[model samples]
Target: MAKPQVRYVCQSCGSIQSKWMGQCPDCQGWNTLEQEASQAATPFANKHNLRGGGRRIELASLSSEIEPAPRRPTGMTEFDRVLGGGLVPGCAVLIGGDPGIGKSTILLQAAARIADNGGSVVYISGEEAVDQVRLRADRLGVAQSPVQLGAGTAVRDILTTLESQPAPTLLVIDSIQTLYSDQLEAAPGTVSQVRAASHELIRYAKTSGASLVLVGHVTKDGQIAGPRVLEHMVDTVLYFEGERSHAFRILRAVKNRFGGTDEIGVFEMQEKGLAEVTNPSALFLTDRDRPVAGSVVFAGVEGTRPVLVEMQALVVRVPSGATPRRAVVGWDSSRLSMVLAVLEARCGLAFSGHEVYLNVAGGLRIGEPAADMAVAAALVSALLDRPMPNDLVAYGEIALSGEIRPVSQSAARLKEAAKLGFTRAFVPPRGNSGREIATVEFPTLAALVDHLTDGL
Candidate 1:
């Protein structure tokens, strides 16, 4: 028999080393190496077949008629929105977020809803005791729902207890990092343990035809805490994001096998729990009837949903000795700088001695470049102290050559803006996209600047 040896492993990048070191060579993280059992073959000799020992699998044709996968609705519209309608049977979902981001709270409420809808659900928490989860359920007013709860960290024990019963409709594992397999000598939350436990849990879901949801802790960089392969092993990966001080939360889907990616679910936290915000566009726009300088409504699209959000800008003169500052809230700071430079070089609008600040109203983050024209409008409006018409909306991409470019889904943007009672829209020059509102096209950045400052 061969004896097991120990080796050092980098927890940050999942790199294995022959010996321990103060710093990891792969990720350059200090003091992140941990000792684990080595899988080297010594004198151990267990002979088996050199090849072929599994059952033959049957193949199916693409044209064959097949029943579609059934969806289990948890009765939460916002939750279902992100999952692309509802949860599919045998789907494995990985939800990651920062500490105290309400990941656990939302999952508990979901499990209770599923149970109330006549579906059997099991919630196994490795991080909290059964009583603790029950207390939270009671606080959320869902204690009456018949959801089977268990608290354990041993993967073997968990699988064993689940073997004697029928397959549940839904299974939740609170934190896969806390689960440790007896097959591996490594401690819980290590890379090897997380990978092995997730594999087993996902396999169970596949074989039993039950929906599985796994909660994951995030690293300081906001990524899930595990080997990158852990994310690849799941069918869906969701991220819960928001500022801790804010009441609104955004549940975004980065990867989904059964649905579209980049889809988002908006929720508001309150004393009752998380409530769904059905009309996110209306929630993001504030006092749209009253015109204000440096504030313009941007018709933007988040995934498949069209959203109208206010873009606010401020430009002020700084002292000769003080450096001008460029502060941003929810939009990219570099994009703002580019807009400022274009206004200066292309439209002759001086911003060198002026401090600039930009913010996207509501807690939502804007990533699309289609916001460039709206941002430019806000900057011009602010610098000239000219309030834009309350009935107008704008969206287009700007280039360094001072040209306005057409954005995708222009029709949707215009439709959303008009639905919000806006009568005018500024879009890039393109073939007429049929719209319900009055469209004012901008051929270049200079042209829009002329319109803003001509009579300021």
Candidate 2:
């Protein structure tokens, strides 16, 4: 028998070190290092090393015919969309979000629907009691479903009970942090325990061809709380995002092996449960009863969907010698600074003593750079006290050299804006449509500035 070697590992990043340190050198996270056992090296045998003959392995061509992995629909279109149409068999999904952001609510609803649709579902809660889960199920109107429920913390006990029952179509673990394997001396949620527990459960899921859903806890910085390897081990990773002041939640897929990544599914939080938002653009648009300065509609793409969101800007004069502050919400502040620099350097504008604030309405964050033109237009409109047309929308990317770049899915953007009763659009040069809506194409950011400041 040989003694196992001890190694220190960072819980946040899974970086191993020979000795412990107060701060992790890799991730710079403080107080995250934990002790774990390193397996001893196996002894070599003369007979095994001398053996030459071995079994041959089979190989397959790239064009070989085989049946595709079957997918089971969770009965919710929004959930299915984030999982890439449907949940593939043996797929492991990890979903993380802010506390009280409805991570459990949505999963419970989906589990009930799967049970109702003649599929077996077993929901195991490690944090909440069985009765507490039942109360939530009743509130979500899913208590009548035939879904088996249990509350436990030990991974060994959970696997033991699951081994006796027939393989279920779907298995949900409320959280991975709460399960601790008996084989390890480390506590639950530690690096070694979490890794070992996840590996064991995932191995079982693969052997049984069952889809596994793991709800993950998020840190204060909004990242999943665990070793980085947890995300890599899973087939798909999802982030449930929402503003506390907002009513809607965005389920985004950052990684998916079976489906398209960068896809988003919209859901609105209500009393009953999470309701799918079929037309999210309508909810993000502002009321057009009266045209207001510093407000412009931006035609943007969320995943494959064309969404119209309102962009607002406010420019105020700052006292001399005071550094002008730039505050932005729901959009990138660095990008806003770049747009402002182009406006001042290329468009002959003076914003030295003016404070700038920009916001994307509806609490929906806009990451696509296509909204650059709209943001620029709104800033200029606010600075000049000129209101843009209520029926006008903008979509284009602006470069530092004062050029307006064309974005992808032009037709999709224009069609969505026109359908929402926008009669005019300001987009990048070319890709115009034959619709009744008039389109003004800006070849450069200077041209956009000229139109917004001089032509207005």
Candidate 3:
């Protein structure tokens, strides 16, 4: 008999501890620990389980001669771009997002694309029936009935279907949280059930050469739901993030084993479905109808894509003892503070008693240093009561010493800006080769201050 077990496990990381704690040490998450049935008597407790073999292996005998298989395209340009052109056969992908955030729409569209390309796709959804899915497809304008499954659909049925199909197949599980196995007595979405289900699915994907796309749920804090092990077991992880009140959604890659993880796919949510924003810079810059003070254009790079966005800042005198409020939207607050302090120390801006607020015009979050120049310009515009020229753009990083630092791909940034009708640009002196945009090179913050105030 099992020695009647007891222990609390962290739901996030699966770390087991002897006693319950408010915060998990492994994942540093509060209230994530939960009691689980003891594993002492389970088959997993024995190291000899699963193949009934000894665990010892000789490392010297292992061969590194495995050849990698070719990748297949998912059929969506934006989605394909994020996955480094296409999906690798046998690669497991996890996509997480809030409910009704278009996770199912994107995957369905991908399936249709694959089918159009003469590939087979199996889409399993536990949340919706086949008829409901078909209605949604018709509404999205795809209008197709390629493959479908309903709840109570067993994994054995899916495996059999794939075995009979000769074409390359892309399998999509609407959500991993809903899948369960009779082998595991635990309920679905529980730690054991999720892990066991994912393990089996991952194994099936590899052995069958089927590309698997698993949809996951995100927590209130925007992390993938279920144990963190789910993220580690997959080949790629993508998150759908955007304000629900808005109609735009951004799919960003958090982890990619076969490609760069910095890629992001922008989509516009409409009555029809999620439409790809091929030229995001243009879409983001559309609201700028006129040039205004405390507003400037910033050219930044997201992965290999060059983006031109607007930065707006406002400065006002505070009436109370509260430290001047520093509010930020679409950018990091601490980063804004760092830029503000740099401006005060290096450029000698008098902002001791002023309330400052900064924002990136779009709802997108930007982290690149290319935003530095535009941010600085906006702050100065508010300080000097002057607005940056509507047609002007800026891109560079500012050090604490007020020195302008070179940003990546300045030429590409300038080319993108020029395409958007920007005639003038401010850039770091060192990085500016003088071939792009009527360049206004600033060596230091002090020089920039002098240049802007000399004629005032």
By summed lDDT, the worst window of 10 consecutive residues in model 3 runs over 145-154
The residue ranges of model 2 lying beyond 4 angstroms of the native Cα positions read 1-57, 434-436
Tell me the tens digit of each residue's lDDT in model 2 across 1-456: 767779999999999999999999999999999999987634543335535457677988999888977789999998998898888888899999999999999999999999999999999999999999999999999999999999998988999999999999999999999999999999999989889989998998999988999999999999999899999999999999999999989999999999888788999999999999999999998778998999999999888888899999999999989999999999999999999999999998877789999999988888988989999999989999999999999999999999999899999998998898899999898858628678988898888887886765
Q: lDDT at 150 for candidate 3?
A: 49
Order of models, best lDDT first: 2, 1, 3
Worst 10 residues of 2 by lDDT: 41-50
Q: Give the TM-score comparing model 2 with the true structure, all chains together.
A: 0.88
lDDT of each: 0.91, 0.91, 0.82
Question: Which residue pairs in candidate 1 have backbone atoms (N, alpha carbon, C) closer than 3 angstroms, thus clashing?
Answer: none
lDDT against true structure, model 2: 0.91
List model 3 lDDT by residue over 1-456, tens digit each: 666578899988999998889999989999998987676755556664566676777686457786765779877788988888789988999999988889999998888888878787778887788788888889987766465444443556555656676524788988888878778778878888788888988898888888999999888888988999999999999988777766778888889998888788999998888889998888777466765778878888887788888888999988768778889999889878888898888777878789999987767778887687788888888888886677788888888777888887888988988887888888888656546468888888788778777742
Per-model root-mean-square deviation over C-alphas: 10.7, 10.6, 10.3
Error of 1 at 399 (Å): 1.9
TM-score for candidate 3: 0.81
Q: Which ten residues in a row have the lowest lDDT in candidate 1?
A: 42-51
Candidate number that wins on lDDT, 1 or 3: 1
lDDT tens per residue, model 1, 301-367: 8889888999999999999888999999999999999999999999999999999999988878999
